[model samples]
Target: MLFFSQFQTPFWFSSCFSRTIILFVFVVMCCHDDIEAALVLPNNETIPAIYVFGDSIVDPGNNNNLLTIAKGNFLPYGRDFKGGPTGRFSNGKVPSDLIVEEFGVKDLLPAYLDPKVELQDLLTGVSFASGAAGFDPLSAESANVITMSGQLDLFKECIKKIKAAVGEERTATIVSKAIYIVCTGSNDVSNTYFLLPSRRSHYDINGYSDFVAGYASQFLKDLYGLGARRIGLLGLPPIGCVPSQRTLGGGKNRDCYEAENQLASAYNAKLSGLIDDLKTVFTLPGTKLIFLDIYYPLLSLIQNPGKYGFEVATVGCCGTGLIEASIFCNPTSIPLSCPDASKYVFWDGYHPSEKAYKILTSTIINMHLKEFF
Candidate 1:
């Protein structure tokens, strides 16, 4: 009767409308499943959104407009993506793009920096990751990219807009339920500490790992304070085995840098322990902090390429597959890419190929479906 009251009808006709009201109520009350099916994403049954934060590993095109050498808005970069050269470090879709596809919403996650992004896109999700950003401000500064804190600030600004558009309650729900993925730390170790001598001069490997872990802890805490509950913290891969790192060592004759791999392993362990500590220390009741392990699968692929049906695990598809990346991967200098990118593990020098990224993301998602989805 209350539901029927919404319709304008005379009180004299109330008796005549009694049967109609009963029928209307029966349809609404009994056909709840049908109504919910019509409302798509009802009760956030599907992940309402996916918020990505990281460096080049997950960066879409956020670095394109920034004054950064980490930019990838050029040919041979996005040769396999929908739109060419969308600032993804890889030859095609990055891990974030493929991961979002599993959610069954958007086919690819757009960059937060894209000017065309609308309120609807914000409600779904966006990637604020820059190609070269790291947990350390120094690393981001060196790459001329947005820092981790800067990404959080952008997210906060986005939240305000969302609140204005859809009210505070819905905005909070969207943010709380959205999946938050952070894929940094590689730049901190690979770019900041290893490449630059200043950090090495100050702290050794142990101290450096702790320092990075501290910053990572702060990052997660800040995100939690912003209402994020489901967080996927991607562990550092074996950066020493990347083509660029290997090329820096000695080009073709060089082996995997064991020292750098050891550093990454230590950092991954500390980060895992840090997540455990955060879960215990924080009072977030519904919070789910997940540590995504990418080391073993990637290691297996690298060590035994044939087992994974990959012909080239040591080199990239772009340029000479050595130290080339970003601007260095231009078509003019490098010419055309390999006929089949699936054969190669790395796309350029630092990032993985689209096929490799798919495999890695699939493994991670399968491993942590319960925690995230």
Candidate 2:
């Protein structure tokens, strides 16, 4: 009787039915947009540049100006990179370059140390990541290199220089409007937390894991306070899977260094929990603070090479996994050349190949960004 009465109601009563139809349409649109797409243009808001921070994996050339011998500005390193290597730690370009490229950045985001870069480079983007950094600052300090916090200081210095050049108003706009991408933590485990016998004696693996997560959380909070309205926090990748680490324990008869890889996996899990805690601290609208899981994606490539397109996924083409990283990664050092770089996942012993870097960037953009833009 109620249904019949409603259907038989006057034409003026049809507004509710119209609202229902509108709501149905809105639901359909929302469903289609469920994946969030920061891949799109900055909608109504400002996202003119990207600020890159982390270790050599994402470092552009922060070490170029420094007198450190750990530099990638030489040939063979950038021979395939836009006609010449410009100190990027990767074989070709890294994620930092791929991001600005995919976003259709007009000018190339310059390394903070590039003398050729103008004051306006900061507007497009600027790479301030040091060659050494992790969840802890001690890794870099122990190596006598710049730590993550030290890199942030370098970023601050760049900001100051930019302000002097472009005035406070424009500099403020550039810093506030850009996206902050931070990728760190691997170094801390390999160097400070794991490599240091003193640290191992002090903190067990779980204790070290908690300590790392705590440091990461605090650093992220600092970034938030530094006018980083939009930020993408990348968790640590499978550190044990790196060729160098793999060579450390195993004799190739078995498989991976399961112990280290499991530690890395556990750390990422803890990081996921940390991100959840972080969200409660901030409930602002339109502020993106997402944790991208590169480990899963990169590990997928290693486990299933056919998914991406590769024959060999295990070994690096550069040098024998034995003595290829650290003091051995030299483009000029023909002694380090591998037979087939494309087939292997890692380029050298430590970092991924250009192809692998490409996949990492694509996965982060396509798999993760559908919701955050």
Candidate 3:
């Protein structure tokens, strides 16, 4: 084992050790004034708040109250979180909470439908995401979750509440200045088009990608019209590489499902081009639209797990780690979850572990922070 003290620190260490140090420093900085000091941009302008809209990737607890099977409000879900299971899909804080915390805005991004959310929470923003939601309306309809349009309707209500609380001017400032994060489309590719025959019978992979990208374009346009000037749209990750997809489509040996991955890449390509076009065509002045690429970052961690201090990248830490996810991953399962989640890239078959999320969030924020301004 290697050890070092504050005064006798070595100049070199293993890549994993260095990564751990970086993550440790990041967590430490987030504790107090250090986060503000470290996150100071050149312009000194801070994000007023953060509003999230997407699927389970960003959903905190919106699915808890909904009559949907996509819920994750049970043990081993938020087991690592301070408040216990609050409906987050992962073991602890999801990307929605991480983004807000990284920006020093707040500790958690409460779900809009959460009863605990107060007027003060609305000013800082709340998540309008639902588990299993997607850009395609049918995807959500099939899962009995909120659709993209339905989330927008909720957002409109949220805006009305904010306006009522702080007047129109302040609401406008908060809406325009705050960062809006859109992270969905995984369920659309992995579930609706591939697994379900309804869409596949009518549209091929390319056609379906276009279909989803069209809806995504419209969503961005609608958000822009609603006074959202700064938007961070996340591209789909490697859905095929997740454990559940691997078990289903990766053949008997369980390799990465290339077909689903290709669909994700195609959709991302189309969405990226659309975002660029929207900036020049549909967007008004002062609009900052960026397509955050989560594909390669997650792919990197999976392809080379040791570089990021992860031992199990192909499976999850929950239950069997091959097929268990959401409700399937529970305490009553035959075998309990792994004792140490830090060594795993995924918390469940579907969602990344909290440690992996922190790494991804850091990579994404570093890549796009300057572009947002």
lDDT of each: 0.72, 0.62, 0.76
How far residue 251's Cα lies from its native spot in candidate 1, in Å, is 7.2
Q: Candidate 2: which stretches are off by over 4 Å?
A: 1-46, 67-69, 106-108, 331-336
What is the TM-score of each predicted model, taking all chains together? 0.86, 0.83, 0.89
> Candidate 2 lDDT (Cα, whole model)?
0.62
Q: Per-residue lDDT of 1-373 in model 3, one digit per residue for the tens?
A: 0000000000000011111213222332343111221353333345677888888877878889778778788988888999889988888877777777766788999999999899989898798887888888888899998888999999999999999989999998888778888888888887788978989999988899899889999999899889887777788888888888899999998999999889988988988898898888754556688888888888888899887778899898999899888789877642678887878988888888877777777776666655654
Query: What is the clash count of model 1?
Result: 0
Clash number for model 2?
A: 8
Question: Which is the leading candidate under TM-score?
Answer: 3
lDDT by residue (tens digit), candidate 1, 265-326:
88889888999999897754566787877777687778988766678988788878877878
Q: Compute the lDDT of residue 47 as modeled in candidate 2.
A: 49
Q: Which of 2 and 3 is the better model by lDDT?
A: 3
Q: Candidate 1 at residue 233, lDDT?
A: 81
Best by lDDT: 3
Q: Where in model 1 is the C-alpha error above 4 Å?
A: 1-44, 250-252
CA RMSD of each candidate after superposition = 13.6, 12.8, 9.0
TM-score, predicted candidate 2 vs. hidden true structure: 0.83
Model 2 misses residue 19 by how many Å?
21
